[model samples]
Target chain A: MARRGDELMEFSGSISTLEELHALSLMVHEVASDWGISEKVLFEVSLIVEEFCSNSVKYGGIPVGVGIKLADSVITIMITDSGKPFDPTEVAVPDVTLPLEERKAGGLGIHFVNHFADTIVYSRENGRNILKIEKKI
Target chain B: MLINTSQKENLQIVSIEGRLDSLTAPELELWIRDNLASPEFDVVMDFSNLDYISSAGLRVMLNLSKAAARYSRKFSVCQAQDHIREVFEISGFDSFIPLCDSLDDVLAL
Candidate 1:
C-alpha cells in the first residue's frame, strides 16, 4: 500500500484483470463515501479511475497503484502504473461533433478522463507512468 | 446489475438497475447484440434505476446505437439519472443517440 499522509486512502492492485477493476471500483466508491464526498463527485472520480485503470490493463499491460486524498472542495488522485511509457494527457481528443457513422470509440475513454478531471498531469519516471488528477467538488 | 426485459408493442424495453461499469458492460453489449440479431428490431434501455456508468458502459451504448443504425432498427435510452445523463452529455452521446425523458417518450418514437 502507498500512502502520502495520514489523510490519504490508497489502493493498489494488478491491472491485468477485470476482477481487479471491479475491486478497484468498489474500493474507490467506499473510500469516497467514507470521506462524505457527494455522489456526483464520487461518480466522476470513479469514472476517471475506471477509464484509466481499464486502459492501463488492456493497453499498458501492467500493475497499477492509486492514491486518493480528499480535502475541502477538492480531491486529488494519483495513479501509478508499471507499464509502457504512455501519457494519457497527451492523447488526442476525439471529435465529438462527428456524425455517428464517422465516430469511433477509440479515444473516448481518455477524452472523458480529461474532461472530468479539473487538472491532469502525466509523467514517466523509473519506467513507471504516473498520472495525477484533481477535481473540484 | 439487474436487467429486466418487457415488451410494449414491437419494442423491447430493458431496464437496468445498479451500476454499469467495465465488468458488466460486455454483458449488456452482448445482450443488446443478441436481441438485435433476433426478431427484435426496436429496443429501449431504461436507466431509471441505474446508479452509475463509466466509459466502458458508454462504449457499449455506442456500439448498440451503431448496430441499430446498421440494421435499420430503433434504439434509445430513457430515464437516465442526472449523473448518468451528465456522463452521456459530456461524452456527446446525446447528439447521436436518442435520449428520452421517459419510457412513454421512447414508445412514442
Candidate 2:
C-alpha cells in the first residue's frame, strides 16, 4: 500500500483494475470496522469507494489509486487516476422514478455516490483525476 | 458470497449470505441466467443473510426484475436488511420488485 499523505491511508490494490474491486471491498470493510464506523455509515463509505473505483477501473484508461481518511466524525475518500479527465460529480443524477423499461443501468452508481456522499469535489491537475468524497459518520 | 438455492411452492428461493459488489454481481447474474431461465417458475431472492450490496448488485436485481417481465414470471425479494432495504428504496428497486417478509410470504405475492 502506498501512503500518499499524512492522513490518508492508501489501499493496496490498484483502483483501476476490476480484479482489485474485491480486495478494495474487503479492505474497506476491515478499515471501516477498525474505525468503529456504524453499519449504515460503513455501507455508504463502501458504496462511495466501490462505485468510484470501479468506474475508474472500467473507463479511467489507466491505473488509479484510492486513499481514505477520517477526521471529526467524517470519513473522506480520495481517488486519483491518471486516465481520462472524467468528473463523476458532474454526472447527471438518473431519474430513479422511471419504470423498469426506461431505467438505465450505468448512471445509478453515480446517483448513489451523489446520494450517499455529503459532499463531492472533483478536480483535474497535472494529468491526474482527483476526486474527494466526504460522508459524516 | 454464498448463494443457497431451494424450492418453495414453485418459486426458486435463492438465499445470499455475503456482500454483492461488482466482482460478485456478474457471477450471480450468470448463475441466475443459467439456472433460473425457466419461465415456468417464479423467483424470490432471500436476503436475510445479505448485509451489503452496491449499485452493481442493484443492477443485477434490476436486470432480474426486467427479465421477470420478459418471461412473464414473478420475481421478488424478501427479508432484506435495513441497509439493503435503504439501497433498494433509494434506487427505486423496492417499488418494482415485490419485497416479501419471508419465503412463505413470497407465495402470497
Candidate 3:
C-alpha cells in the first residue's frame, strides 16, 4: 500500500481496458482509506476516479496515465490521456433545473467530477490532456 | 442494484438492494423513467436495504429528481445505511432531495 504524501505513484495503461479502470479505482480506495479519510471524503475521491477513468475509457485515443499524490490532508489525482484536449472544468454543468424531456442525455460524468472535486485543473501539455482533481480529507 | 417497487395511492415506492454501480445504473434509469416519470405519480426510493452506490447511481437519482420537479411530483429517499447515506451527503444529494427514516415516513410526506 502507498503511504499518504508519497511524492507520486504512476500507472500507465490503455484507456479501453475495464480491468485497468477497476484496478485504478481500487487503488484509489485503498490509498484513501489508509490516509484516514472519512467515508464521505472517500466516496468523493472514488467518484472522481470513476468519472475520470470512464472518460478516459470512452474517449482516450491510445494511452493513459494516472498520477496520484497525497499531501496536506488532500489527495491529488491526475489523469492524462493521448486524446483530444478536454478541459473538464469548462464543460457546462447539467441543468438540473431543466425538465427531464428538455435535459441533455449526457454530461453527467463531468458534472459528478466537478461536484465532488474541491479543485480541478485541466491543461494540454506534451500532447496529453491532463485533468487534475483535488479532494480534502 | 436490484430494484422492486410497490405503489401506494399516488406514490411509487421503489426498493433497492445490493449494489448500484456503473453497469446497472442505466437499468435503474430505465425503470424510473418507465414507471414513475409519468406526470401522474410521485416517487420515493426505499433505500433501507441498499448496500452500495457508485457515481452512475447518483446521476440516475439526480435525473429522476429533475424529472419529478418537472411534473410537480416529489422525489425522495427513505432509509439508507451510513455508507450509502455518506455517498448522498458528499454528492450534495441530501440537500437536493428529501430523506426520511423509513418507508412510513416517506408515505406520510
Predictions ranked by TM-score, top down?
2, 1, 3
Q: Stretches of candidate 3 above 4 Å error?
A: A1-27, A95-112, B6-11, B18-21, B31-42, B49-55, B62-74, B81-97
Q: Write the per-residue lDDT of candidate 1 for residues B1-109, one digit (tens) a residue.
A: 8889989888888899988988888888877666655435587889999988887898888888888787787889999989998878877889977889987898788
Q: Is candidate 1 or candidate 2 better by lDDT?
A: 2
Q: How should the candidates be ordered by DockQ, best one leading? A: 2, 1, 3
Task: List the pairs of residues colliding in candidate 1.
Answer: none
Q: Write the per-residue lDDT of candidate 2 for residues B1-109, one digit (tens) a residue.
A: 8889988778888899888988889889998888776556898899999978988999889888888889888989999988888888988877789778887789988
Please rank every candidate by lDDT, starting with the best.
2, 1, 3
Estimate TM-scores for all models.
Answer: 0.90, 0.91, 0.71
RMSD versus native structure for model 2: 3.2
Evaluated on chain B only, what is the TM-score of candidate 1? 0.91
Model 1 off-target regions past 4 Å? A1-16
Q: For each candidate, what's the DockQ?
A: 0.76, 0.77, 0.23
Best by lDDT: 2
Q: List the residue pairs that clash in candidate 2.
A: none
Q: Write the per-residue lDDT of candidate 3 for residues A1-137, one digit (tens) a residue.
A: 34435624333344456556656666666665665677667666666766777777677754567766676666788888888887777776666555445655356667767767888988899988888888776
Cα shift from native, residue A64, model 3 (Å): 3.8
Candidate 2 accuracy as TM-score: 0.91
